[model samples]
Target chain A: MIQLIAYLIIIVLTIIFLIKMIPRKLKKSPPYTCGEPMKFEKPETVFYRTLSNILGLKKLQKLSTGNLNDYLLMIFICFMLLLIVLVMV
Target chain B: MLAPYAVPLLICTAFALPVFKNEKLIKAIAILAIFLSLSFVLSSSIEVFNSGTKVFAVSGFKAPFGIVMVLDKFSSTVASLILFLSLMIAAFSSKLVKERVKEFYTLLLLGIVGSLGIVITGDIFNMFVFTEIMNIATYALIGFTAKKEGLEASFKYLIIGSVSAVLMLLAISLLYSHVGTLNMADIISRIDTNDIYLKTIFIMLILSFCVKIAVFPFYVWKPDVISGSLEPVAAFFIGVMTTTTVYVIIRIFYTILGIYYSTWFSIIAIVTMIVGSFLALLQKDIKRILAYGSISQLGYIFLAFSTGLAFQGMYHLVNNAIIEVLLFLSIGTMLMHKKMMEKISMYAFLLGALSLIGIPPLSAFFSKFFIITGLLEKNLFIYAIISGLISIVTLLYYMKIYFMLKQGEKKIYWPIIILIIAVLLLSFVPVWLQIFKGVEVDLLARNEYVSEVLRP
Candidate 1:
């Protein structure tokens, strides 16, 4: 029991020391980018755009433009392709 | 018997709605009428589940001669779901829709009629008629605001819907000429699966339904349509309209055509999942993100369907519908009452978003688990993996919406709260009801469906 109490005391002291060691004040500095501040992009934009490029989704996205004629053309092309595949199968 | 009556009741209520000028009276009557319609559907669905399939033949004429409504396990369940969502929409819209209250409820009921008719009707040509009715009503509802964007979206949808209708009628006529009958059961027995013309008809029919259901290349209209409309109307379109069209596709492919598997269909489903997720990742608008999310979710359903996992597909469909309605309505509530009940509204939206992401202790997770297991059973390891990865992407996009929520509330709490409870209860369905196994068996029992409709 004495040993256990001693260990608990040690754990509490360690946690207190760690908490006190954290800097309460710090110097602020602008990020260095060859003496020019970097332009910031939304994390969502960066992550998704990078992923989208990797997946070649730009072409698909391009086709999804809200133009009615584009939608019709794409539907027609897909329909014809489906018909061909069905006939072959 | 009660199933067929829902359409007329809704139509009658729709016609009667315009006569009343008082907004409160209009809202009361609309809610009462939809409540009645829901009760009728619920009772008939219970009858189907308890006894067996019920056939309601019009004018005492039998199959292959006159129109009939077949209330089998599948159709009854889907019909019940459609009406239930309509009721929730009616209740939610009562508080949100103040301007043109009469016209709004009237169009809403009319849309319900179209969807209910599509689900219950057992004739192929009747299905075509109901599809058109649903399409016209949907176009009007999308343009209900009469805003520039809304009108443009409505016009685009109208054009696409018209072309699809033409394709559907052409296919149906060709089918009738070939089979000499419009009754689904009769046609099922008469169809020669090997015929070339039958293949053409199948492709054409699928293309038409694809437009309605908003499959991959055809899904461009949905986000625009959803973004342009009022939030509750968008909820109705996303939750009720798209799902009803999916039910039609399932009925046609499984019951009528007897097609249980197709490689090309599964490929299209996978592509739809990939494209929808990628596009959703790119969207900044909350509604558009949800619109694309629904498209991705539908792909999951189609994947399950194409892989012979109809039960799992349907389970997911129910989960997706509830989640979508909850999310859309919560957002609508937040926007309408910005200061009143922001805390509860935010929590509701968070719960809905989590459910959509398929987090554990939520309904979608179980349905998605079933679907993945089903794919594994069929040795579709790649498709299973893809679906799992897409869920992660789903989480990412949903987080975007979560980050966007500001605050809001009031009066619409009951509907959203009821929906939240429904979503929670659905996770326990397999444990409590033990109904899914029976439903799965019934779906595979194509011969039973045919016999029920044809029995004199």
Candidate 2:
């Protein structure tokens, strides 16, 4: 019963997130792969940087925090995943 | 004994790789090892065709307990294809790529071994082991360039692949608790199909395979990874990795999962096809375009296999791999020039592009024809219509690529000519044969496969 409630809460939050992330104006070009290199900032969390180094992913973790479109797309993808989990769970 | 040597020899050579510092000698050794393994696979596959399924239990342990390798029509067909393609890639790499050659070949060989293991293993745990091997090799190889792009792509792929692997391992562990075995055939024979947990496990496994094969939703990493890798690496990933993953999906489809959930599979394929086409249409980079094309092609394989036309699916799988490898190699040669493709390279690219577009007399067209026929036979009119529309979409993008090219003269033509003739001959042969032999001798021959492994 606890697990069921937890799953429901996760689903509701995910749906809310997806709905918020969807842009009103659909852009003709995606913000990703604009042939420019991404510059990521230092991680605010110690845990994230530590984990990153351990996994040899410190290099990739430097995604540009400034790209609005990538942010939305990433969140949008997260929502889709959460929706899938809703079905699976 | 001979058929199973490919995987072990590859693994051993990979371990021995770091010891060598002379890059040229390392490359020569890599080529020689790949050639010898290819020869072994060829001989074993021929033997299997002439007689029956062959099994090699690792370290002499019996089935339901030991790691087992299978050499039958299904595995040999895909394995030999993987090897032959790898050999081509070895030759291609030896000529072009020079820096970090040692580490690159090691990863390449490891990736090949992992792919071979997927098709040849009889144990589920062994499959998981090989999956890790493949994923790690791929992660390292993609980032091999150490440029920000390559590192970024490899990192994304690593995160996604690791999550999927964890999910798969969890499902497998749960399954072992229920069934007390990890051998695929052993588990299949003992599976409680109606069990709720079993169904969940099945879904988890499918999800994992989805990530590997770059199906919709989970395919986010494919474009970056493909676009950022070196030419030969891209060819191996696009050609061999996709084929092996689809082969495993087909194997799992037959041996474990029943047809009760096929609708979901078809729906996934349809969405994948539509999404792949739209995104592929949008891509500007050559490698990313080819990557999206691979994703779209995988949908056709799934659609045909979903409709129970396994033979047609296998036909497309093999055909697509060969076509894509030749295309990449030809394009690699062209890209070696600063601004324009030479005449010979242009024609070679045109052959692959025309084949990809399903132009008549090309191999891709016949496979697509058989798939459409299968869908129509099932009265899936909507699906058939959508498929026809997608074929036009495919042609549109390929034509876009052709229009984008500017020509200059270059010197690589013979390898592509050999590949083209092979594709043409394969496409042209056996049009009148009524019954398709299918990939059953290795894939569907579960009883023979199981018994052979279980035998002393």
Which candidate wins on TM-score? 1
Candidate 2 segments exceeding 4 Å error: A1-89, B258-261, B431-438
- Predicted candidate 1 versus true structure: per-residue lDDT over B308-341, tens digit per residue: 9978888888888988898888888765765333
Candidate with best lDDT: 1
Q: Which residue pairs does candidate 2 place in steric collision?
A: B342-B408
lDDT of 2 by residue, B1-456 (tens): 597877778889988988998888898888889889999999998788788778787888877678878777778888888888888888877877678788889999999999888888988888989989998998898888798888877777777678778877987898899889988878767875577777766766766777778776666667777888877778988888888888778878875654423766787798788777756655567888788888888888888887777777778888889988987887777556765776776887888877766666778878877777777777787777677667766765565566567888757656566777767866764851222353543455556655776676
Model 1 per-residue lDDT at B374: 80
Q: What does the interface RMSD come to for each candidate?
A: 12.3, 17.3
- Docking class for candidate 1: incorrect
Each prediction's TM-score against the native? 0.91, 0.82
Candidate 1 chain B, poorest ten consecutive residues by summed lDDT: B429-438
Per-candidate DockQ vs. reference:
0.22, 0.02
